[model samples]
Target chain A: MLGKFIAGKFLQYLIVIFLMLTLNFLLPRLMPGNPLVFLAGEDVGFMSSAEKEAILDKYGLNDSIIEQYGAYIKDIFTGDFGYSYQQKRPISELLMERLPWTMLLTGLGLVLSTIIGVMFGAISAWRRGTKTDANLLTVFMFLSAMPSFWVGMILVSIFSAQLGWLPVFGAESAWSNYSGIDRIIDIGKHLILPLATLILISVTSTFMIMRYSMLNVLGEDYIMMAKAKGVKEKVIKYKHAMRNALLPVATVFMLSLGFTLGGATVIETVFAYPGVGRLMFESVLSRDYPLIQATFLIITFSVVIANFLADLIYPLLDPKVGSRNG
Target chain B: MNTVLSVENLSTYFKTDKGIAKAVENVSFSLNKGEMLGLIGESGCGKTTVAQSILRLIEYPGKVVSGRVLLNGRDLIKASDKDLASMRWKEISVIPQSAMNALNPIFTIGDQIMESILIHENVSKREALKRTKTLLELVGIDGERWRSYPHEFSGGMKQRVAIAMALACNPKLVISDESTTGLDVLTQAQVIALIKNLQKKMDLSVILISHDLPMVTAICDKIAIMYAGNIVEWAPTEDILKNARHPYSQALLNASPDLGNPEKEVVSIPGSVPNLVNFPNSCRFHTRCPLAFDKCRQENPEFKEVRNGHYTACFLEGVGNHG
Candidate 1:
């Protein structure tokens, strides 16, 4: 049953990627004016007519639509995302340079937020109606309501500008000549503000979801049965109750993971962090079609992949889904 | 006879928005070893509340105001947290209602049963597994099918698994709180029969809480009839059947359709259960009791023994055939 479910999901995601690829091919072409003109750069005005046709031939844009589409699909599979004339670099290379920074920032943020949020949420639900629960709820309510960029500025102003304890902007102190551990330390210090901003905005949603789910699970008959069985208090809370409550949170975690990988755009902009989100923002402004298409394609694919992982994991958490599904 | 559990003067109240709802008021009963006592009551008569209060499982808004739940002479109400934890499942366990949801959906049947055993006893997982298999077989399930999750089983099968889980650690007292409720009538009969068989074979003391009068009369050795949070009559099942002293008990028996006597009229009891919030200081069943007098409305009746092993709380029991 599990094998069949995986096969079904695999086929579904494959079709989704294929359709996305077709759209990616058409979006840049569908724009008014010639894509070859964008590819030729500002030199297009001085160039001969033969030069413009050469640019179109180089991209295989002069071929029939079906042939161009076939080559587009084949090129995507081979990891060839075309060239960015604006940056004078390959789209894939540009994306690769920025991917790690995004990964590190959002990766740390996702892990920290989920852990802290889920733990505190479980604790709050276990002690619902207490002063501690009420206080935490109030704080997270405010945190969740605040926008990410605004929170980023507030954190940056307080910790970086006012306190002078951390870097104000960018991922590192440029030209500081730091290396190894010293360079890592500089990056870490720079990371604190944006990571905090991301976590502040993201954590509350997980916390609320976990708390609501835990409260409902705590009231379930199985939880009562576990209590009657005389299971240890910690075991009851963590194992029986928390395990069951984790189902919804697991899905949320994966979704945020995918979105964060695509990049925390607003937070990244506020921090001036050199990540995929910053690159995507600039690429859009410059109308770097190849770069824009590549970044969007990566984002959509990552989101789909994350949701796929969630589907695979759901059955492990809930046994009923595995056998009953298909 | 050895008394396995004795609940004395147990009153559990729920703090509702209206007032303190006396869910279970002054409920008292004792079960002898190897015996089954059916706690019969109408809906909202605090049967489930009594079960929870005995186990001290009542949550917020519900408190056990006054009670002494003595399990084998040890007062569970006064037992410390550690002591209570150690005694649970080892000494007493419950087969909950809605067996469909009683077992964790994520865990296998064996793991759930083994958990209770491993918590209370010093045993290897292999030994626990062996015992779990025995329990499953004893409950009429295939021993090897313990790997199955709760959803894999039918409703009756799940109820059987619940019974198996309750008996996992060999608890002396097991409370089956309407565990057969959601099953079809045929499946209900089968589950009830399994419980009866287990009680006799294991010499287990059982409290079968249900509103099914005919089923209770057929299987239980004793019956306690509750009316509006109070047990109005307690006696041997035969005694309650032949000479029901409480008007409420008689009304309940009359209301049930007896398969043995299809010709017998099945009368429905009039009036819903009274709202227990700030109830008046008098016999709670006075409004529905045919023989109620000025005295019944003026004060609460005392529960006292009128005959050997027979008890009731009606003023008429003391008045000697006044009806």
Candidate 2:
């Protein structure tokens, strides 16, 4: 039964990816524009008609829509994302360079925020109706309402422009030729503001959900039984109650992890970080069709895969799900 | 006989916007070692409250306003938090209502039982696991089933698991608070039988809290009938069954169906349990009592002994009338 369920889920995700790929190929082409113009940029006016034809031909833009789509599918399968018109480089190479920065920024932010948020949430729920709970609720409510970029800007104005404690933008010091740990430290310093912005903005949802979930679990008879059994207060709260409460939050964590992989565009833009989010933002503005398509496809696939994992892990977290499916 | 638990003038009240709801007021009962005392009551008569008060498990909006729960001579109400913690599973434990929700869904049955043993005893994990398997077997479940989660079991199995968990630390007293509530009739009977068997074999004192009068009459050594947070009558099983003094107790016996005497009418009590908020200091059952007189309304009757091991709180029983 478990094997069958996994197989079914895998099939569903595969369909989702196939549909996303088709849409990715079609959506960019459906936009009313000439890729040759985007490719030429300022050189568009100076380029002869013959040169323009050569450029279009090189990109296979002169082929029929169906023929181009077939090649697009084949190219994706072979790990080739074609070329970026705006950057004058391969789309795959551009993504490769930007993906790690996005991963570092969002990966660290997600891990830290989830740990801090889930812990605070559990504590807040445990101390429900108390001053600490009320205060946390108020702060998270404000954070949930505020935009990430606005938070980034405020943080920049305070920490960068005012105190000058951290860098205002970019992923590293531009002029530094520093190597070894110094270079690492320089990069680390630059990562702080955007990373902080991501954490503050993202943490509210997790905290709120966890608090709500924990409050529900606290009322379960098992928790009362645990208390009656003389289980330590900490063990009851963290192990018995929080373990069950974490079911819903696990899904939230997995979803955010997938979304974060695409990068926090607003945060990346605010910090001028050379991450995938920033790359996608620039691609959209310049209508770099290949880059935009490649980024969106990767993001969509990542989300589908993450959702699949959540489905697989849910039965482990909640045995009831497994029985029901079986 | 040595008393295992003695509850004296125990009162638990819930603070509400309307007023203080006297859930369990001036309740008193004593259970001898290895005795099964059935705390039988209507739905709102505060049976669970009395149990929680005894365990000192009452939380916010609810307080054990006035009580003395002496378990083996130690006053639990005044016991320090650490003292209480040490006593909880080791000295006394509860088999909660809805065994369905009483076992943590995420944890294995063995792990949950082992947790209780490991926390209170200076045993290694291996020793705890070994003890957990034995407890499961004692409760009529396969020792190997300890690895299963609550959801992996049937309702009866989950209840059995709950029973095993209750016995994890070999508690001197176990309170089964409607632990058989949601099970089918056969499952309920099986669970209760298991408890009775374990009680006898282990010499464990148990408070079987339920509204199932017939079941209580069958297994309990003594019975306390509650009416609107007051213990209207308390006596040995035979005395309560054959010579009930309180109006509520007699009414309860009349209401229950008799299998042997199939021709006998099953009559339900006339009125619903009274609301307890700011309840007047009079007979709580006066409105429902068929024999209620003006004197019954003028003052509350005291729970006084009329026969050896039999007590009742009713003016009709020739008890003193303060008014």
Error of 1 at A131 (Å): 0.7
Candidate number with greatest TM-score: 1
The digit string of per-residue lDDT tens for model 2 on A25-57 reads: 999888887777788787888999999989888
lDDT (CA) per prediction = 0.90, 0.91
Candidate with best DockQ: 1
Model 1 lDDT per residue over B136-184, tens place: 9999999999899999999999999999999998999999999988899
Clashes of each: 0, 0
Which ten residues in a row are the worst by lDDT in model 1 chain B?
B314-323
TM-score for all predictions? 0.93, 0.92
Model 1 regions more than 4 Å off = A1-5, A27-68, B290-295, B320-323
Ten residues in sequence with the least summed lDDT for candidate 2 chain B: B314-323
